[model samples]
Target: MALLQIISAMAMAIAAPLFLGQPLFTLPVAAQAQWSRVHEIPGFGLGTWRSNGDQAAHAVEYALSLGYDHIDAAHIYRNEDETGKGIADANVDRRYIWVTSKLWNTDHQPDRVEPAIRQSLSDLGLDYLDLYLMHWPVAFVPGDGTELDRETSIVDTWRAMEDLVRANLTRFIGISNFSRRNLNVILDICDICPYAHEFELHPYLQQNDFVNFHKEVGIKVIAYSPLGNTNPIYNGRHGNLPPLLEDPFWKKLADVKGASVAQTVLAWGMRRGTVVIPKSVHENHIYQNMFSLEINFNVLEMYNISQQDKRARMNNPSESWGVELFADLDDHTSLDGNKGQEL
Candidate 1:
């Protein structure tokens, strides 16, 4: 795909304004001064998709202390209660925080959507969510995360999501892990446009085409796993890839700027205009990741990092237990080649 070409061109164009003395290159002084100003909602946030209850709560507290006002969660994570408790502990006004949750793969059937949302709300101890998402394009049988029967199409699920928004159960509703094909299915049938789209995005697996397409359609792109399985010490499932923290290039930049590698990666995502949700249970890492908001990298540095793309995807449906059910996912070539194809 020519995704890289588009990314390269955009990077160069964005740099032009910076080189010409445009104010856009520099971080907004007002924003920097008010960094800790009452739950400010920037494009960076915490994603609780992979953590358990206690860990997620700790992460939330860490994020809150570090000036993050956005928290991404989902029914699949089974940690909404912890996330809610963490928010409550922060003593921040509910309205000040931007909370996002997702409908699971199994809850796509029209009949199952509302009940699922109600369950999530009950679990989260909230009346409404800031944003809700259809977790994936394919629908499964209710109650089973792995049962991919396709009982309900994405359009039908989207129709249900529209109803949720109309009913005020959620302020916004969007999709996750959906290809361009799946997104078109929703657009053709739904009256309301998606507010955002969440997917696995990192330097190695640079989903530039999808990001651009979402931007063109006015849908915000929320990037998950911005740090591509860097620390082998964290979990072995991540497989071995060049750790983001130790990458020679990033380390060189980090040393020059006196910033952490994690901060550098986070800044890269922010520079690209995608909301990054990096999950961590450790307090230090949480603070470290959140501090990325205060740092800004120049165009050349950002371009240098972008060139490190290896298309390494950490989360793949093909790895699930029901291998045959998701066999098509193994065809990485189709995914890599069919840029912007409808689901």
Candidate 2:
């Protein structure tokens, strides 16, 4: 996989100028500015997956003030406009902020990819995104985030994503909620491999195999709900789950380390070499999350955290999607139907 990524990158390096009419190493000033922050994305990020209204805007402002450089959002999150306001209100240079959003499932069609990104860009009031992801590998009903569209192809969708890079709408493009099956497919046909893969990951749902797979293939693994999605949305994935913050085992570890449970968990994730985004709207929580890098966990503690995994997946799709997305997710090796387009 590493060899393939090297080859893919070399091909892109050679082909970029030939196809896009510029030196491969040289992009416009705006693009080059955003590109500089991609390396620091692994430590932490502020997630706005279900944030709403003006509060969402203020929360973004608070996060930015606390020194958070990465903001994870999605078009389906329905708060790009709010987040955009927050980014602007913060008075930070736009280039210094690392913004990521997703392409909605409804926009899986070849012709609709670019349009979906444009709307997100317009809503965010930004000219370009640091990273843009296909929110999910499965297409869905046009208006819903999870109502599956069984007819669309993920491979085709990715081709459109490649077009996004050429168009300079997103500095980099990626996938979220994709299983290994789906990622392998994208790599197979991609002239430029995806920069990262986002998925629901935490101590309880430690997807070690899948997480390691992504890194092995040269894709950075970005974790959403890094502390577990304790907040409910739609039908609610976090409601009845065990409170990771209050878990006695985890708490003991945090107490020993003089770290909060949230910090301990985030530290564990960073130690594993994946970028973990733990969402928060509160000022204290956001600030404490910023200091997570100061927290550390030893090998035994990491083993204990690993032992907490129950394969509990919080972001499973519903029957409304009309596809067996949850049960059959790992059964294939590619999108089979997961084609996509521009950002």
Judging by TM-score against the true structure, name the best candidate. Answer: 2
Q: Give candidate 2's total backbone clashes.
A: 17
Task: Compute each candidate's TM-score over C-alphas.
Answer: 0.79, 0.83
Error of 1 at 240 (Å): 6.3
Q: Model 1: how far is 34 from its true place, Å?
A: 24
- By lDDT, the best candidate is 2
TM-score of 2: 0.83
After superposition, the stretches of candidate 2 with alpha carbons farther than 4 Å from their true spots are 1-40, 141-147, 233-241, 326-343
RMSD of each: 11.4, 9.2
Q: What lDDT tens digits, residue by residue, belong to model 1 across residues 66-123?
A: 5567889898898998988888777554445678889987888898899999998888
lDDT of 2 at 257: 81
State how far residue 105 of model 1 sits from its true place (Å).
Answer: 1.1
lDDT, candidate 2, equals: 0.75
